[model samples]
Target: MTAYESLGAAVRFSNVSVHYPESATPALTDVNLEIDEGELVLVIGRTGSGKSTLLGTINGHVPHFTGGRLSGRVEVMGRDIATHRPRDLADVVGVVGQDPLAGFVTDTVEEELAYGMEQLALPPATMRKRVEETLDLLGIADLRAAPLRDLSGGQQQRVAIGSVLTTHPRLLVLDEPTSALDPTGAEEVLATLTRLVHDLGVTVVIAEHRLERVVQYADRLVEVADGRVRHGSPAEILADSAIAPPIIELGRYAGWSPLPVTIRDARRAAAPLRRELAGAFPTVAEVAPPPDAPASPAPGVTARGLRVDHGRVRAVADVDLAVAAGSVTALMGRNGAGKSSLLWALHGTGARTSGRVHLADGTDPASLKPPQRRSRVGLVPQSATDLLYLDSVGAECDQADQESGQPPGTCSALLADLAPGIPHQRHPRDLSEGQKLALVLAVQLTARPEVVLLDEPTRGLDYPAKDRLAATLRRLARDGHTVVVSTHDVEFVAIVADEVIVMAEGEIVAHGPSADVIASSPAFAPQVAKVLAPVRLLTVDQVRAALPRNAI
Candidate 1:
């Protein structure tokens, strides 16, 4: 005889399918699923795999706001979504989109948290109590007075979660909830979500690309692909799913029975595999940088005593490094660790107190005109969509071609190479995050700068898109372009980076060859390294190459 006993399934979809009028293909096809109350579900899929489309239906955004052809029934908390628009269902469902910054309605952390409740017009005393509770629950009490824009990407993400959480909705839906967070921050958020599900009986559904951080906590896994929806226990879905974390991939590679989903589980079962490769300890020498590589080249990017500050805060302090031509350097660090600040400073953009960005060709990037600077050294910011505002994808490509002074179809050609078969007439806003990223990347690469800087380049990319991006970076490096990418994806760094640079509190703490540096830290190690530690392998392909023929 409580509120929990009254509700049936938190969300139920019966023969639901969606097709955008502008799109030739359906985003989702005949999906039928039910999420029971208090269950925690993880939605997994490749980019543009209809995961977003599925989540949108629960909160009444699919056909209501998106103007899509949605057929069938979607009921949340015993209320039909066909009749209840998002505003009407606000009390039962709360949604947090991928780009948290775009959804902000206030400047300060506390203000943003309270803004949602104010829309519902709750009593002042009730709103105050809920706001305080949400702030403490999300561990952002210290940031209440801080401006939302000034906070780190992770901080902004926390505020966004708290904002929706203040509503006390029965169901919470999130898209890429931890995409911007560091490893530690992501862990904290997941733990908080776990507590909410167990204690309050709140059902939660989340879509995430980094399955490594989320799968173990998932009560079930829901995969959307090829116009189908498959739901089952995490192990059953991941057993054959193409979209998976490094741990799952490792489990498959070694043929681990009942596949381990977490690091602890993998460790307990890795003993036999460990023994097989004992005394085969890979020498640091084997993975070390090429001996003939230049320590410092005149025609490369260099920084001397570089420092960046936002007001009185020293985001990056006195960092010195050299990026040689024809190599990719990955900047790895935790949230608010100054990786983004350093990348922006290096590219001669963002705020800087003191920094000397010396380009190889005897030019100071900061001193050049904005348009001239873009052609000489291009940058794709953390939120790539900020650079896109044209009416259609084709228009944006045309603008990039004109701006870069390249051939008319240059940008379009690059876009096709990066993301195939994207409708040129589609609005950039309607594209998935991965597709948007690919578009911006194509726009920048068309300029053909000698030095290219990308912040969180793999934020929303799927496995295949990541593979394609790796190949693109390799091609750029082969053409003698210096590529510096700041990212939290250790697996990606393993594949594309020649060097790894670890940052903390706005300074470079460790710098070495990619394989050597990644293998040294437990938190930064790729799944392959964690599984085959003694062998010093960095990727699955490396393990395949090292093992005997027909070993599997």
Candidate 2:
């Protein structure tokens, strides 16, 4: 009898190991695991961890699609993946990757949803019915006729998911699906997935970095780290791992019997602790800039009555802002709330109907030449690859050196500091998401511009990589550069940002110190603040420093 014929598991791996051609060690080493049918599993780990390698094994992509050496056996739905390629397993496994824009094959949403079903050679009537059903299920009926390129990041994500769901596969695999979405959109996507798991009996496997959004819905948690795999319940796995949500850390700090994964459970566990520290004020750090600190005769950059339009659409309207030298500012907002347009306007590149940007010399930025403007202001857009279009990594770095008027190895040195170990001879497209962002940022920094801007810099980075990025931004600020970033990662903002700017509907709603603004906003608050509030603490490290020895 076949193994899966007797057992109810959807996936099984036995003594599996994978080694890339250029790597020294296996990405996954001696791994044995089984995922039961109708179970929703979550995979968590640091970047370059074996999470992707493990996820790819179920569909035969690790050994078959990607040029890698595989050992041992993998079975999905009672079929050995070693003998069956991905196309043969299409009816059983459906995969969706990180970038939705790259995944879609058609220009319109409706056509993109139908393309997969057509490739499978489904009946025409069945394809039409399934396309409409998926559009309604994902709440994207309004965008059925909309062009895929024109939609916002969150909308594109919804369409991508719907396109894959139309196939009715028994096993679904998603890689960081909600990384591009806002809070509300992320919740919507998760709710849809939850329904699919419970009502349709489909098996779901997801690898995601934003644990806060997916942990509550997970039936089982699998962690890939240090060339091994660990599996347990959500609380059991997160109890010992450093990567956890704010609520989980709060439960650990209070010495609760079991870690809480949801806000409701956390509140129930913290009732006694809340009563114990009713009137206590947190030890505050000096985060806000002094009023007199930027008291010099000129500000680093100034924008007054800034207005941007896109063919009768006011993407940005009447925005005024300023930043002191040597400060790191974070721009945060919901999807489609004008954050990207504002950043582009400040860099003197996007559409500007009426606005004036002045540097310390009181010169309008719009009047400068392309070379002169780039040396003064540098921007890394959401599509970072747009800034990188060379034959190889070494070639790109060399070109950056020439454009910025820096020495021969200046860009190479900066890239090493940002993300070491990237092969110089490899193609830029072969690098991971985090590595790509680092390369672009290093190239921009080679110019030593007075101002630097990044849009969604944490899109696909893991926790360890984020820590390194935070440290680099801090160093840049100390070196007297005005750094600004547009992102939705509240945890990252807590660690790196000195100032916070909140935008809504093409206007600034609040601008102040990072600690105060983040603490006040419900949507923007970090994990630590959610649990330890009334105290206004932002990180677990701060809470540990403030608590007494016997508190735990």
My TM-score estimates for the predictions, one after another, are 0.94, 0.90
lDDT of each: 0.85, 0.82
**Residue 366 alpha-carbon offset, candidate 2, angstroms:** 3.8
- Residue range 1-552, candidate 2, lDDT tens digits: 766658988999899899988688898999888999889999998766778889888888888878889998888999998899999898889888777888889999999999989989999999999998998888889888888987777778888899889999999999888887766678888998999999998999999988888999999999998669989999999998857766776677788878889877776787776544443433444322322222332367889999988766677879998877777889988777788888888888777889898876776667888899878888988777888899789999999999999999999988887777788987888676677888898899889988888998887787667778888888777777788889888888877887899988889999988878997777888777676566666766665655553764
Best model per lDDT: 1
lDDT of 1 by residue, 1-552 (tens): 533257567888899889888777898999999899999999999888889889998999988998978898888887788998999889889999999899998989989988989988899999999989988887889889999999887788989999999988889999999888877778888998998899999999999988888899999999999668999999999999988887887778888889999777887787776655553434533643432333444446888889998887789989998888888899989888888888788778767788688888778788888888877788888889999999899999999999989999999999998888788998999898889999999999999988999988887888778889988988888778899999888888888888889999888999988878988787888877876666677776665555532554
Q: Report the number of clashing residue pairs per model.
A: 0, 0
- The candidate that wins on TM-score is 1
